[model samples]
Target chain A: MQLFFFKSINLSSMEVFFDENESYHIIKVMRKKKGDIIKATDGNGILLEIKITSIKSNKLIGLLLKKMNIKANKHSPDIGICIPKKTSRFEWFIEKATEIGIRNIYPIISHNTEKKKINYDRCKKIIKMAAKQSNNFYLPEIKNISIFKDFVVKKQKGFIANCSNIDSKKFNEIKLYNNPLFLVGPEGDFSDFEIEFAKKNGYVSINFGKQILRSETAAIYICSICNNANNFNL
Target chain B: MQLFFFKSINLSSMEVFFDENESYHIIKVMRKKKGDIIKATDGNGILLEIKITSIKSNKLIGLLLKKMNIKANKHSPDIGICIPKKTSRFEWFIEKATEIGIRNIYPIISHNTEKKKINYDRCKKIIKMAAKQSNNFYLPEIKNISIFKDFVVKKQKGFIANCSNIDSKKFNEIKLYNNPLFLVGPEGDFSDFEIEFAKKNGYVSINFGKQILRSETAAIYICSICNNANNFNL
Candidate 1:
């Protein structure tokens, strides 16, 4: 069944509607008409069984025939990373991370970041598509690109990765904590000054593994480690 | 320092030469001149320090000055997966696995797979570029596309993943023994007959995680788990 996204889909009510983009997809591209069964979510935990009520060109208003089971997001640690230089690479990370059950993805922009602007709308669409394809109910939180210093100082248990000679604890070696955040640097990586600033703050320095991974690669790897560690019983 | 790939490099005498591809990239793209220091690798274990000898339009030959280091590929468990439908998707999996230290990659062609032809040259080039870009000394062994049944039965330790009601063991739940082999299915996934056939031939059924991942996502996820488990005690 086709899945649609709506911000405030009230399952208690039998009526539902879609955003302009999603309505266009269903009405024009998918050619869905009245009485067509489909699925929808409110970007929260609510999953609804909706049937097309009417379509005015690209606008799709539907009837919520049944309320599907409310599903919770997976229990993996959240990973907030600095967006990479390439948009396709960043989108690739989002797709894979959604499939692998990453809770949150906050795209941070750093000083050495070559790619500054991000297409937030495009990224959100990719995440939604990936979530539906993977049969996952959770859509990871994709935040707007923030500055390095501001992101590092956020109120969350964070880890900063570096290539310096400073010894850092391995990811799996660390104790698992729920809703953890890993800040990945850009292609040139975080500058020394930025690392010092992060250190002066509460963020701890950590090594993902033995290999030197790319910015996007490190993001996915660290996300996987934290995710598995949470589910893994010692 | 810039890095270049020389397939015809002879590691025994520390002799490494650049062909048109490497030469053009170094001279025209990187704007490197004579006497410039750079690093070159054979996509094997050998790393060489080369000083530019002659800068020609067609070829920029370099003299091997010193042996920097011959770093061996990390001792991680081998993972062989079926070639996915999209060429770029398969290439993406190879890139991520190579960065995380996968020893071998066997691109199997399953019965239900939509893609039949494997672009070995293009895929290997991507792997080599990703390996060098990730500062990896060794490239994963890229095997030719083979039949799933033939490859699994012949391998020592084989596993197949499928969407069944059976609750298979999670990847990290397993103990490490020999290098592991995981057969990831295509878009439609492995057929029921294929699953039963693999099971009869001594292949164990295992799940990557709770979420349903795509073929490429599953391949990279499983490789990370196997490598992490193999190096757990170290």
Candidate 2:
């Protein structure tokens, strides 16, 4: 089934309206018309089975036949990673994380982080596109840029991926009881002081493997492991 | 230490010459002078430490100081995956697989595969760049496109990743003795006939997780798992 995404619409109501852009996609591109049924999502865990009712000048009106609210995946990770200096790499990370079922993403500005600014809207668009492509009902929330120290103090039981040779446990070795958050450093990795501070704040240091992975690779590897571990029941 | 990649260079000899492009990069972009030391790789498990002797119009002469030969990672996976229709995605897969320590890559032309012809030279360049960036000594050999049935008959103990509802083991559940190969399908997945034929020829079916993953994502997941499992010594 082909899926479409919508934003800021009330999914609870029986009637839904598609604005100009979506209308163009539905009527002009997809050639969908009245009485045609299509699958649509609002990026809020709601999947709608909608039937087109009418087409106004440049708008689309659809009646909802069914609304399915998908429950959040309990095993998704809340990933806090230092934004890379390269924009494309960071955007690629967002796309993959969304497909792998991440719960939330926090772009942390650590001591070694070179990129501080992020295009939030563009990131959100990428996330939405990935979710629709992968059939994910819920969109992972992209948080604001966060300071390393302030973000590290958050009360969450998680592990920080670092390369500091501190005899840290392998990611799979730890027992996960909740949706754990993982912190991945930037290209140069976290400074020694940042590692010490994170350790002092109850963040357990963890290593992926022998090969030194790039920042985006580390984030995806962590998310993949978490997703695999969580899907044992399925 | 910064690493540079050079092709067709003799590592055992005392003198090494850089061609026009490399000389331009070293002289203009990086601004290295004579007597400066640099690390270079031959993309065949050889790392060379050389000191610049002289600079000509568009060439660089260097004297070899030390030579280091890196052994191939015994745990690297020998992966056979269908080439995705999108060139960028296929290129991205090659880059990630090289970083994750894949020994060989076979582009299989399965029934559902869309792209048949690949730019072998471009693919090789991408692999070399990734190996240099990740500090990998050995470069993965990219094989030519092979037909599905002909490729399936080759005697190899491996698993095939598919979305079929048949009973399949998780990637980590199986024990890997030698460097095992993994077959990933295209966007449409393998045809039922292809899967049956592969199973008849000794390929076991394996699943990544509950979610539907893209072709490249599945490949990376499989490689990451194999890397982690084989790195028990580390």
Candidate 3:
């Protein structure tokens, strides 16, 4: 069944409206007609099976027939990556991260971060598309780009993955309550000063492994690890 | 110091020849002349510090001043991923996995795998480029694309990661003694029969995480998890 996006599913009337852009896609691009069955999610926790009742130029009305909530509440890594040199690459990170089930994504501007200016709106769109494509319930939370120092001050369980041989504590040993954040630097890696600052703030320096990985590769790796942490008997 | 790739680094004489390809990159592209110093790796386990001496159109020779084997020799994951829909995406997987220290990568043909043809030489080149870019010494071993059933029967500690919620053992919990292999299916995932066959052959059914990921994304995720199993403890 084709999937659609609905902000909230009303149980009483079983009616929902899609965004203007998405409505156009359904009526014009997809040629979806009335009584056609479709899948829709609120990008929160609601997944609904709906049938189109009416289609307009900028709005589509649907009757929700059945509803199911895909519970996405779980312990997954919140990987904060320093923006890359290209915005497209960074956008690619958003798509993959959403598919990988990242809980939260923070775009940080570190001393070595190559790309400073980030398009928050575009990044969010990529995240939504990936989420819908993968049939995910929750969308990854995107925070504004903060300076490395300010980000390091957070008291959350922290880890910094860099290119240095600074033997880091393994991910399993760390106590993961609910949300654990892993910090990935840019191509040049976090500066010596940034590492020391994180060290002082009690952010454990961790290596993703032996091989040196690209900035985006490191980010995806950390996210996968945190997501899979619960499976391992640590 | 900039890093360059040389075919071989002589230990006794501490001399090496930069291939015509690399020679052009250094002498013409980067505009570096004789007497300049740079770092070079043979993509095996050797790192060299050299000073430029003779430069020609066909060859560039450098005198090595110091030789050190700073290669990181951590455990590697022996996993194989099915060739994805887009050949370039599968090629990219080989590149990133090699950079992240994967031991063996095979292009398997499963029920849902799109691309059947395997270009052994082209895939090897991709791994080489990634190894050089990531500054890693070891090159991941690439195997010819094998049939799904044939490949599963030959390997042990094999895992099939799919989209289903079938209970699976976490990677870290599984004892990885010898080289282990995991078969990642394409975007469509493995057929029911394939999964049953793998299970009968002692292959464990696994899920990378709760979220649904793309084929290439799943390949990189599994590779990172298997390699960094020990990293979770910290």
Best by TM-score: 1
Who wins the lDDT comparison?
2
lDDT of each residue in B113-226, candidate 1, tens digit only: 878877888878888778777777777788877888888678746778665536466666756556666778888778778777887887777765546778888877766665
lDDT of 2 by residue, B152-172 (tens): 897446788888868677765
What's the distance in Å from true for residue B22, model 2? Answer: 8.1
| lDDT for residue A11 in candidate 1, whole number 0-100 | 49
Q: Assess candidate 3 and give its lDDT.
A: 0.76
Q: Identify the superior model by DockQ, candidate 2 or candidate 3.
A: 3
lDDT per residue as tens, model 3, B43-143: 66678888999887758899988888764444466777878888767776787788666777877888888788978888877887788777676667887
Please state the error at residue B46 of candidate 3 in Å: 4.5
Q: Which 10 consecutive residues of model 1 chain B have the lowest summed lDDT?
A: B68-77
Docking class of 1: acceptable
Stretches of candidate 1 exceeding 4 Å from the true structure: A1-40, A48-75, B6-20, B23-28, B31-37, B49-77, B230-234
Per-residue CA lDDT of model 2 for A14-80, tens digit only, reads 7877768778878888898899998888777788888888888868888888878876667788889
Positional deviation of B67 in candidate 3, in angstroms?
A: 6.1
